[model samples]
Target: MKIDLSFKIAVLLVPIILFDTLAYAGIIPEKKRIIFKGDEQQQVLLIANTNDYPILMQTWIDNGNTQNVPSATVSPFIITPPMSSLAAGEIKGLRIIYNKQKTLPNDKESAFWINLYEVPPTSKENKLVDNVTVAMNTQIKLFYRPTPLANKPEEKTLVTQLSCYGKAHNLEITVSCKNPTPYYISLSNIELNLNNHTYHNETQLDMMVPPFSDNSYRINVDSTNVPQQVNVEYSFVDDKGDVHGVKSTIRID
Candidate 1:
């Protein structure tokens, strides 16, 4: 009877011990997903959870190619409920920004991966824990062509010129359009790339030029830091809703 009792207790304790070991080793459950908004801009948000445990996460963009170089790197922009204890049934949101210009294989469809890591707990004295990670996949589509215009008016021809200046940490660009036609134009779908990283904005400009006249616009590249290369792309729509695109590149020393 005594032997049987001891055997049963050992079996029950074994499973419990294994579970606790896994949990303590940062083997907790986790999930992640990528989301985007439809606009001329390139940005995404990463949503994740630790299933009731506090965790430390790190993220990167894989661009889904075997080229061995990631298309983008995320600088942990925000951490919600920045506390050590991530109570049970808690959700966390992480914002990730990608400059479309820095990504490789420009004008082609690419894949990206967001990796999340669960940081292990450590002790004050000889505290060391193992780390575990989970990943989410996404598809990045690049639109090289301009969208068609809407509401046709009168036919016209226009000439545009662009100039750029580069510094160690930022860029300045200017665009001038000569309107020889009778109608106005709107510029949209503006994208910029630096050092293989890309940046985009959704704001479109309504360029007004008197009949047989000209118009000019300026864009500033006040990036947080300087990049190795810079490229700019944009599109315009005529009064008749006809759309067109232009691309330019610059190398920084």
Candidate 2:
């Protein structure tokens, strides 16, 4: 009886190559939204192994707005259990702690992201070993909020000065919300009412108006279908950095 050395080597390399590809693509985190505030700066994220086999999971944090991974020393936050194994149907906690010495500014909220890589565990079973292992990675948004010393203004006050309008000369529906107050405003649940039609675009719109800054969302519809007025409806984050369901409507002509 004889065995092929080349075939054995190719089988071994396949899993490794697949795992590396998975790590590059990333795994999905359990939590979609992560808010860090108050006296406690540490948060635990629970990740579950929904697969039938064991998986090795690794985690790291990066700037949410950027695709590049952050530097180890430059990142104030530390990810515990940078690498761990998860059994089938297992759930584990990944602790993320923020170093108080390198905390964010007290005036505004900052954004970061947690990414995970999941790889299949090697097995002695011939069937398991023969199967091609595919790895995956997921990234979730992480918000770091500074504990304000003084009470922040109400959401209405923070957004009362918001102005939403339409461009009579152009094909775009413009939503302009200027944050006149010293508090930051996260305008979510945004819907634009134009040309007697309502447009509900959830994914493409991420509006955050910083303190004393002018923020606007330009929605390109069509100049031929221009409306007489534009009505914008949105929700904002409260003093505790929690998004409030309260809705505010503004008009633009």
User: Using Cα atoms with residue i matched to residue i, what is each candidate's TM-score against the true structure?
Assistant: 0.28, 0.65
Q: Which regions of candidate 2 fall more than 4 Å away from where they truly are? A: 1-31, 70-73, 119-136, 149-169, 181-184, 201-206, 211-214, 223-228, 235-253
* Lowest summed lDDT window (length 10), candidate 1: 140-149
Candidate 2 residue-wise lDDT, 17-116, digit = tens: 5443222433324445676774676878766565667788877787644446434425667788888888875556788998878757777666666777
| Residue range 1-253, candidate 1, lDDT tens digits | 1123443344344436534322333322222223222223443332324344444544344433333333244322222222233333333344344444454232222223443334533445434445344432222212221122222243222424323333342355444445444333345555667546665643432343333455544455655565555676656654333467767654444
Candidate 2 has a TM-score of 0.65
lDDT, residue 109, model 2? 65
Prediction 1 global C-alpha lDDT = 0.39
